[model samples]
Structure formats: C-alpha cells, structure tokens
Target: MPNDLQRFVFVLFDGFSNMVLASALEPLRAAKGLPNGPAIDWNICTIDGAPVTSSSGLTITPNASLSQISNKADIDYLVVVSGYGVRDHGTAKVRARLQNAAQHARHIIGIDTAAWILGCCDMLRGKAATIHWQELDQFADQFPDIAVSQDRFVQDGKLITSGGASTVMELMLHILTQQFGPAVAFDVSNLFVYDAENQYHLIRGADWLQGSGGDDLRRAVGAMMSRIETPVSLKDIAKQAGCSLRSLDRVFHDNLTMSPGKYYQMLRLGRARDLAQATDLPLSAIALQTGFTSSATLSRAFSKTFDTTIRTIRKSRAIR
Candidate 1:
C-alpha cells in the first residue's frame, strides 16, 4: 500500500441506488479539492468492470473489475454500495471476491442494504452493524450473530455499516476526520453545506435533540456537545446559550422531552459509547475523556443509562 494515497474501491452492484453511491463518493472529491489536500484515490467497481444499471435506470461505468482487485494489496477501503434488490445481485462470486479483497484492505464499509450482502457472506458476524431502518427487523432476523442497531452507523474495528444514503456522508466525514484531522473534515463539510444542516451541532447521530427550535436551544446543545471532555454545569451551559436555567430547561423539555441535565448525560454517554466501540482506549481513558471523574463512575452511569455494562459492549465489538 502506498502511504501517499488513501485508495478506496466502491463495489457497486446492479440496481444500486445512485444517491447512496454519490453520498459515499462525493465527499472524497470535495476533500481533495481543498488546499494542500490529502491524496485520496477512489474507483467505482463492479463484478465484471462493466457499466451497471442503477435502480433509477442510470448506468455507471466501473473503473475496475472484481477479478482485477481481488488480489491487489494497495486498497485502503472496500465499500459496498447497494440498496433496492441487493439480494438479487449479491451473487456467490461477488461474495467470494469481497472475502478475498478483505485480506488486503484496511476497512470494509457497507452502505444502505449492503450490510445484507456482507451478512450473507458471514463477513459481519459478531460485529456491530446496522442497515436502513425499514429493513431493521429483516436484517436482525437474518443476521442473528451480528449485533444489529438502529444507529445511523456502527463502526466495529475495520468494519463500518451505515443505515442509508442519509448517513453515508457523515460516515465519510468521520473517516476523513480520523485520517486527516477535524480541520480538513470540517472544511469539507462546510463546502457541502452539511455543517449548517444540523446547525453546526457536529454531533450528528444523537437524534434525541433534533428539531427546529430557537438559537438559544441550539447553542445549549452545541455547548453540551463541545464540553464533553470537560463538562460545564447547567448554569454555565445556560449562560453560554444566552438563556436562564429555567428557560433552557423549558426549551429542552419542549423539544426533546427531557431536561437539559438528562440531555447532557445522553450526549456524554453517546460519546463514551462511540469511543468504546471505535477505539482501543482503556475504560479509564474513555471515562476521563468523557468528563467522568473515574472509570467506576463511568461504569455505573453507563450501565444505568444503557442498561448494559461497558465490558459487554466492548465484548460484542470483538472482531475475529
């Protein structure tokens, strides 16, 4: 693998959703357009390196074939993009090709119902994964061993599965942030106007506080997310939000149906959970990073909020 370039191969199936493909592919293009940008190379691929028809009747020409990349050693990510009729095109040959390519890739990503294909190949077994919400029941029933979730996306080690096209952009931003830095990722997001979508919350997956509201409420939520590593008190949060404590509490209750204190706890817990699942950090380090005084405190709060132990969550994310 060349250290100068981060190469990605997007395996697009017949009848794939073009929107989903674009969501995952466009961010790399935008990221590379930045000044002194990172060297990110990507290719659209298919089973035979031929033009494949999308669900909306558009055809995309493949840059490489499955046979061409199965033995390659320079690939960094292999993203499978599928949506409607994913099962019809998930042939045995494609599964085998993906399995072989996994040996040389750094990470494997599943967009939309592509997780169904990965699950069928036994590639997602014992990993934290998710699919589109509409297919949650079927996906769970089909892949019993995989820890399925309704989350926007789940990153267990080198495996990543996103819910659908809506969340795929966030997944790419996360990859950029992890590889380059938040500054580049933020700039890429700004170019796409994605940062303004969530009112610049930056914590995209926490849906508990999502809604159209006044700036005071948005500022409070932003403050809570920003201070996860060194938490400020509710009074301080309200002050930063330019609102009184009672007003902030009312805003939280009206929008999220939870008090500011409860929402802040959820934010911290969500960050802690993300770190626990995605990184190899020790519990003490995660606790400190999330503003808990000690590991024991984090443990108790985590168990109480999630109704499961942190050890259990980490165990489920153990990859083969």
Candidate 2:
C-alpha cells in the first residue's frame, strides 16, 4: 500500500455485528480497484489481543490489541463496530484503550451500538450522534446532553455514528462520494447491486454539506434517481427539482466537483454496470433501461468510463 493510504482502525467487541463490519469495510476494498478511488487500508483489533466472535458466531482475529495501535498521529478514522452486548465490552479498561486510540485518530466513528461505548468514554458529549434504532430510546435517556437523532447516520465534526449495517454502507458510500467524487462512489455502490433510492434522503448525510449540497442537492439527486430508467435533460431535472439549471449545475459542481451532465451520465452508467454485473439481461435491454439508445453506444461509453467492457466484467465475474 502507498504511504498516502487513509488508515482505518476497526476496534471490534466480542459481539460485533458481522453485517455492519462487512458493510463498513467491503466498500473500502472495492473502492481501491476503481479509478481515482480512495487509497485506504484498515486494521481490525479487539480490546485485548484476542480473537472475537460476531453475533452470528463468525470469529475474527485481531491485527493487534488497542494498546498496539501506534500513536504516530497517522490514524485517519478509529471505527468502533459494536453489537448487542455493548455494555459487556464497556469496562473502564476498554474505555481507557479506546480513549487512547481516539487521541491518535483524526476522526472517530461508532457503528450501531458503538455510540454507547463512545458516549461512555465521553467522546460524544455535546455532539449530535445516533445509535442502532434498537437502543435509541435508551441511549437518549442515558445521555441527555448529547443530541440524539433517529437518522440513518450522524456525522457531527469528527464523531460519526450509524444505525445498522445498511446505514453504515450508506455512510461509507457517502464518504466515498465526498472524497472520491460521485462516479467512483456510484461504481462502488453498483459493485454490490445496492439500490440507493430514497436512501440519501434518509441520510442526515446532509449534515456535513449543510451549506453546499443544501436542500437543492438532495432534490436534484432524487430527481436523477427517479429518472434512472429514462434519463431526462438537465433542464428537466432542474425543473423537476424546483431549481434553476444553473443552481443544479452549481450543486453538483460544488459538492461533486463534476458537471451535472457528467454526474447524470455516471449515474445512468452505474445502473447499466449493475445490470451487467448481476443480471444476464441482453445488452439492448440493459441499454434501454439505462437511457442508452443502443448497445453500441453503451459499450463504447462503458469502455471509456470504466476502462473495461461489459463482456470483460461479465466473463471475469463468471470465472469467479
């Protein structure tokens, strides 16, 4: 890996959610293969240097214990992946190790019930945070000082918290989109055949982009999603989103650093890629669904965009 890699340290408790861990980490794995994707690496650890079992009985050995995490100030995000028995892992010793890790990390993320652990360490006080919906009421009652939200995920400054597995995936993708642009993020989403319709609207994904993406951004992305099967003109998209074409362009430009036309094309191509990777649909059918007039046009565009043909990806996937 390059020295420029973004390092993530995953501190997993004994009952960590396997689904949530996979959702958080798999996108980072997929992102590395895409053009201009994030240069990222991760290490999984436990409170002690021991193997931990997931809620579903999957056992994972740690790269190191929390004490082994270097305090070189190179850690980008210290992610806490939690599960049902959250309190079971929240001993004073565990909190001390986590607090030690937090000091070296630039940011901290709590997935699912991990927010409780973070709160126990006083890391989330005075910040808007969330937890797995199962513990929301109890968490709110426990920590009245912290702003509690029922949104899919919350990113207040360096403290990030998510609801569950799917929301964690959304949070990861939103991070990808923020850092690597919409195209790479879109490809990562399609790699899993993940449909994000109405999901972004669910994201307090907007908290960070309060000023830039603003209200118009979601509206514009929403409109684009609704017309994925039959793409409309940029003007029509802007009109449907109740914003001017210039405002729509500005939204994409400011947030994604890409033109609206480019983002729309990428979005449609992502749909085509999803079809190619997961379905045996004919090229013409795929093209029609993704707003390409013909397979020839789609083939050329896909080759230009992804640097691999639909046939190549299909053959590769088949061999796997």
Candidate 3:
C-alpha cells in the first residue's frame, strides 16, 4: 500500500471546547484505520508547550509549542481550535503564527469560535464563513468585510469554518471524502459510528428565509423549528401560539405558502440531512432522531420530497 498519511496539525488554545477538539480528531483516527492501516498523521499543539484546559475543565498537553514547529511545508492543514477566550487568545504572536502557517499549509480550518480569530487575522477577509451561533451577531458586527452566515459549515477555497462542536465532524468528513474515495470515507465514518451519508447546509445566505415575514410568522416558524425532531400536532402548535388552528394555518399559508405540517416536515428533513452528512449515524437513527416513524417511512418521504434516496444523499456528501 502506498504511504498516504495526510498530516494534520491542530492548534488548541485556553478554554477550548473539548467536544469540538474530539469531533475534529476522532474522524482522522478512524481514517487512519482504513484498509491499508493508518492513512493520516495528526499532532496537537499550543501557543506555548504548557498544558491547556478546555472550557469543561479537560486538560491536554500539546506535543509541541507553536513557536517550535519547523517547516510548515510538511503539513497538509493547520486547524485552529478556539472557544471562550478567543479575544484574549488572539495575541500578536498567535496571529503571526497563524499568518505564517497559512502561507505554507494547503488549507486553514477554524472550529467553533475560532472563525472569529481567523477573521481578526484577515484570513477571512471577503471570504464567506460561519461561526458558533452565539458569536454570529458580534462577529458580523466586527468583521463587516467577511460574509458570515448561520450554516453548519462553510468552505471557501482553502479556508474552512464550522459553526459548532458537531460541525467539526462534518468539516473533517468533507475533507476526508475529498482526499480519499467516498467509499473509504464511508468506511471510516462507519468505524466512528457516524452517519456516512448526509447533506449539510453550507450556504446560509440571508435569502434562505425570504418568504418568512413579520413577527407572528417568525414566532410560528420558530415554534415549528424547535419541534422538528418531535413534531407536535397542529392543535398543540396553535395552543403554543395562543391562536386557533385555522388562524395559524392561514398565517403559514399566506406567508410561507405551505401547510404547517409540510413546513414542519421540511424542518425535520433539513435536520436529518445535517445529521446524515456529518456523522456515521445509521439511517434508522437519523430517522428516529429527526422524528420519522421508521427508516422505511423516512426513505419514502425523503425520496418523494427531495427526488433522491437517503443513501444516495449520504454517499454524495461523503464523496464531496
């Protein structure tokens, strides 16, 4: 077998989210176990060699200090994992390291709140990206030059940014699929128990919800969105909205041009797509988690609505 170990370096900072770090690392570990043995080599690093503590109090000792790394040309990608103290951690030295690394690495990936750090370094200037939802407003307010969205993940050429902890898995899966064949990525996903096939929303442009208008419609939409995984009946939704079922139906039809049931199904399918695309979860698991009665039911419904099978969707995402 050819030595195809893809080298990856992850830079962790103080108060980073451990789940985000795991989500990024686990897929690579699984990929290493592919048919020909380990296919990837990864190393953890910190700005300093000192142990770094995660937001949840998990401590990890880096393999090396960022300042000690030699030729960057040996690395395939440099991923920066950022969280709570993103602003404090974005010191001049850290930014300089990132800027210098970007010059040699094939791509730069930012997880969780690190996208803000990338934006601060001017790496994301005029690039489309996404960060954790909590930081969206402030990130946009601060980096007006970059196009920010609410997507699970966004990849613009060599720069990639993910929105949350789970998004890291999706981003890595995307990279794996691109480097290896979709079949190998799918096998790696199965080893990790992730759903090998899923469609993730990458473009979160403002126009996504163009038809959803007014405060009442927005509230109704929010209620519908929150219940996608375990949808409630229209009467129950109406009670939640403090309005009659007829009134709610009329509002949905007028603004969104779809029945509440249909809209709710769309929301559930969207969630299903995200779960399927990012992880190695089973179709049945995705269906159950997203509120489908059974995998068979979900397959029929998914095919009818999206004009494709769930398996096909998952395979396409895995390869892409």
Clashes of each: 0, 0, 11
| Stretches of candidate 1 exceeding 4 Å from the true structure | 1-3, 194-198, 201-320
Which digits, one per residue and each the tens of the lDDT, describe model 3 over residues 1-320? 23666788888988899889988998788767432334688889987678999999989999987656625446788899989988887778888988877776888999999998898789999999999999999999999999998888998999999977667777777676577644344444444542211211221111122233334444555566567778888888777666778888877676445687886787677677667778889998999888999999988877887677778867888789
Best by lDDT: 2
lDDT of 2 by residue, 294-320 (tens): 999999988999888999989988999
**Worst-scoring 10-residue span by lDDT in model 1:** 203-212
Put the candidates in TM-score order, highest first: 2, 1, 3
The sequence of per-residue lDDT tens digits that candidate 1 reaches over residues 21-67 is 88888889977855446899887888778888888999888877966
Q: Once model 3 is optimally superposed onto the true structure by TM-score, how far is the C-alpha of residue 178 displaced, in angstroms?
A: 0.4
lDDT of 2 at 257: 66
For each candidate in turn, the TM-score is 0.62, 0.65, 0.59
The lDDT ranking, best first, is: 2, 1, 3
Instruction: State the C-alpha lDDT per candidate.
Output: 0.80, 0.82, 0.74
Which prediction has more favorable lDDT, 1 or 2? Answer: 2
What C-alpha RMSD separates each model from the true structure? 15.8, 5.7, 12.8
